[model samples]
Every structure is written in structure tokens, then in C-alpha cells.
Target: MDVRSSAVTIPAGNADLPADLLVPAEPVGVVLFAHGSGSSRHSPRNVAVAHALNEGGLGTVLVDLLTPDEDEVDSVTAELRFDIGLLAGRLAGIVDWLAAERPVGGAPIGLFGASTGAAAALVAAAQRPDLVHAVVSRGGRPDLAGAALGQVRAPTLLLVGDLDEEVIALNQQALGQLTAPAELRLIPGATHLFEEPGTLEQVAEAAAGWFHDHLHPQPARA
Candidate 1:
């Protein structure tokens, strides 16, 4: 696929967030990555996953949930990262902007999130069921999403490291509460970051497969 990458500063309330937009020449769908707590659009793991998804013919948008000044304050207060409502609103605003600006061909749009960002993704998906087609989380803190978990209607996938026992338990608990079709995958011998050799690749593969299966258009037979 021919992929083009660009940067945009999207208007968000009183601030502008720098976002990296990757659009495929023939897009199957689009994914928006919501980075985890203390992470940004610069996160290598999220970038890796976005690259993998691009290879699968999906456009990706990775946006900074906070502007530089807001992030600076969040570093000390930790207030912005944990506020699911605020983060979800930002994600929703970005999605709304993309819906109007992009030529998506009615293709599926999904949320790919890590850690606390997963909660935000869930909340956003819940709020915009008509626009969001799927949701995926890695090493996520879905429990932090609270009541928003019940409102999610998209097909949701949760991926966790096998040895990360606490997170696996949290995912399982959240999975039970979710109203949507959901599945949990445990990658063995992997830690929270999936830093073990080949683990992140597996994570990417699983994510790509899920997005492809859920987002891709059916081929027209010759």
C-alpha cells in the first residue's frame, strides 16, 4: 500500500494537539491510537503498531491528547491522564473532525489504545457508536473507565501479557461488564510492554488481524 504521512495541529477546545496522520492509498479503514498514561504520540510501541496497521492497509491517526503546556502540568498533577471524561471528549472531537475531513468510504473506524488510554477509548467508542467500528486495548486499565465500560457497543479486543497477572485479571473483570462482543488474548512470556523478543511483533500481528477482520472490505470476485 502507498502510505502518506503528515502532521496536523487539531483544534481542541482552547488548545491545539499535534497529530500524526497516516493515510494509505487504498484504505481498508482507519484507526485512531490513544496513547497510555504518561505516553504521547511519540511512543515507540504505538508507532510500531500503527506501522503494522498501515501495512495492513489501514490509515492511522496518533494524536497527543494534551498540548505541550497541558502535558507539562499533567506530569506534576497526574490529573489529565486519569480524567477519562476529559480524555474521551478529546478523542471524540478528533474523530468528529476526521469524519468530516477524510474520505473514509464508510470503512470501519476503530480505537487502538494502551494502558489508561484504553479507558478513554472505551468511553469515546461508547459516546460515538455510529462512527467507531471496533476497539482494542493492550495492557489496558479498563477498570478505570468505570461505568463507561457498560456503554461500549463496538466489538472489543483486549490483549495482555501472560505474566502480567494483575492486568489480566482487570481485563477479565472489565470484559465481563462489557455489553459488546469482546475477547481477551494473553500473550505468554510477555510483560506489560511486550518487550521480550518477538512479543511486540505478536502483539502487532494480533492487532492487525483483529482490525483487518473487523474493518476490511470484502473483495469483489473477478
Candidate 2:
């Protein structure tokens, strides 16, 4: 199955953010990614997971929340990373655009987020409950989602590395705060980035499985 890929640039708050879209010949669901702080859409780990999802018949969009100029500044200031409201607003705009332009037809939409990006994803999910079906956070800092945590209705999966003890505790707290059906899976032997050998594959599988479970097929008639 050859997947067709395209480069899309969406207007994000007066700037154009580059995105790479991968869709199967026949897509089953769509997973939009929110890259971690200091990590662009070019992050190899997220790209690898997106490839795996494409192979599993899912469509993927790896988008940069910040333009190159803003990213450069944030790379040093770390201010943009914590601006959950701003990032979430941009994500919601993209979601609305994709919903209008794509052939997804109310197909379940899932968010795959990493690091501080997870907080943005959560806020977007809370704001657009009608469109977002599920969410998966990979080594995410969901604690930054703030009060939005209690507003999320979509099923969510939080994956963290066992060796990332601090994050594991944070995710545990986020799990308790989430009003949605949610679970926390700690990948043994993995660190905050899941750089450990074979751990990323585990992250990919867990994400794909979570999307599969939460994105329901339109009601089937007997």
C-alpha cells in the first residue's frame, strides 16, 4: 500500500506553518499531531510514529504550531512552549479547516501530542468536543492544561516512560483530573523522549490502538 504524502501550509495566526500530511489510499481515521516544545514537525520520533500510523490505514498530519521565526525565539525563551491558549487556538483553527476541506465526513479525529504540546492538544479537544474524538499524549506535560483537563470529553491515552519518574507522576495526576475515559501507560525502560531501544515502537502501537478503540465506526446496521 503506497501512501500519498503532501505538504500543506496552513494560515496560523498571521503566519504560515508547514505541515506534512500522509493519507492512506483509503483512510480509516485522521490523527493530527501537536509537536513537543523545542521539537518541530521534523522530529524523527513523531515522524516515525506517523509512518506507522499511515501503514495502519490512518491519515496523519504533522504540523508545526510555531512558525520558524517564532520557534527560533521560543527555542531560547521557552515562552511559546507554555502558551497553551495561543497554541490551542491555532490548533482549533487547523482542525476547523481540515474538517471543512477533508473527506473525513465526521470520521473520528484524534490528537497525538508530545511534551508541552500535549497541553495545547488537551485544550483544543476541550474547546471542540464535537470534532475531536480522542487524544494520545506521548511523554506529555498535560499538567499545563490547567482547568481544561476537567472539560475534556474525548477518550484519552497518556503514555509516559517509566524512567521519566517526574512526568509519570504528573501524568498520573492528570489522569485523575480528566473527566474523559482515560488511562496512563508507562513504557518500561524508556525515558522522557522514549529514546530507549524499541520503546518508540511501543508508543506507536499504544497510540494506534487507542485511536482505533475510541474512533468509532458509524453505527452499523444489522
Candidate 3:
């Protein structure tokens, strides 16, 4: 990793929440990850993107929106995994904790989400408009965010797979609900999981560019 990264367990606002924080030596900004409910900080795909962001001088926080107990329950009930409100609350709690922690020296924050987690990220960003600078979603269900979409102020980028027609349509609808700056992009020939050759890399690059342009603007080229 180009950035000196570490695994951190943050107690979100004194709550029993575990978070994985990766801050670069001189970070341009921090991207807080809201992973799909079935996934956690250990998600290989998210980790790959995080590493790419770190290499590009951005920090990352990969957190579980659900507690271990909640995860266990949801594994069977399949309820909390889609609970955008509950997940958004947890996401907000982490942002509050980061405001106090300042581990990366008070950098601007962006949010990256996948699957249903993207909905929660949008809701959380809508709720904390001043704190969050931007948002990016991958193969996401942003439509689940509901009315909160109209309240989002941060620029949003929605990435969908070309072959995932239903998801693409959903994202197109959600993209229209946004009152803030937004765009819906399609990754050619990829599926819902984006397992196609070099597809995930394309997602990572697009997310990096979006975050860099909004949260971490570079100086004019010499």
C-alpha cells in the first residue's frame, strides 16, 4: 500500500461499534464505506477499492452498519440487511465519532456504498449535508433511500452494470430524484457483481476521480 494504513476499532460515539479506519500519511480526504448488509469490512471488493483510494492519497473507513449480534439475526431474518434507516443511523454515528476523533487531521469526508448499503449512505449524507462532501455507489440500490433522495446536497455518482437491466433502471429513476448534482454510469458488459475482466478496476477509477474532484482537488498540472 502506498499509504501507511492500519486497522482501527473505533467505538462510535461511545457505542459498541467496531470500525476499520485507514488513514494515509497525507490524506486528500476520507471515504467512509457503507458496505452491503451481508458484507462487512472484510469484503474483498471494497478492500480493493479502498486500497486504490489510499494509493491516490485518500483515507478510508470500512465499517459494518450492523453489529455482530444484528448481523447474526439478519442472516436468518433478512430484515436488518435492508433496513436503510437503521443502517443510516449507524453510519451517522460513525461520522459523529470521526468528527471527534480527527485521526486524519479533519479532512473532508466522502461516502462509498454498495448494494443496499448505497441507500443508507445516501440517507446518511442527506441527514448530514454539511459533513459529507460527496457520494459514490457501486451496483447499488439507491432507490431504497426513498424521499431522502430529494434532500441530498452532496454530488452523487451511481454506477451500475450494463447487463443488470433492472438495477440500471432503478438507478436511472433514483438519479432523477436527486436535487443535487448526480450522474448514472454503466459499466459495460458487467453483471451485478461486476466480476467481469477489469470491471471492478473501472469502478475504482471512477470513484477515485469523483472523490478527488470533489473532496480532494489537485493543483493545476505543471
RMSD of each: 3.2, 2.5, 3.7
Give the per-residue lDDT of model 1 (tens digit) for 1-222. Answer: 689999998775666889999988878889999999999999999999999989988999999999898899999999998888888889988888777666445456899989999999999999988788889999999988889889998889999999999999999999999999899999989999899998888888998888887774534336
Tell me model 2's lDDT, rounded to 2 decimals: 0.89
Candidate that beats the other on lDDT, 2 or 3, i.e. the better one: 2
lDDT of each: 0.88, 0.89, 0.88
C-alpha lDDT of candidate 3 relative to the true structure: 0.88
Worst lDDT run of 10 residues, candidate 3, spans: 213-222
**Residue pairs in clash, model 3:** none
Deviation (Å) of 96 in candidate 1: 0.6
Weakest ten-residue segment in model 2 by summed lDDT: 213-222
Compute the lDDT of residue 116 as modeled in candidate 3: 93
Separate clash counts for every candidate: 0, 0, 0
> In candidate 1, residue 38 scores what lDDT?
91
lDDT of 2 by residue, 19-46 (tens): 9888887677899999888888889999
lDDT of 1 at 216: 49
Deviation of model 1 at 23, angstroms: 1.1
Q: What ordering of candidates by TM-score runs from best to worst?
A: 2, 1, 3
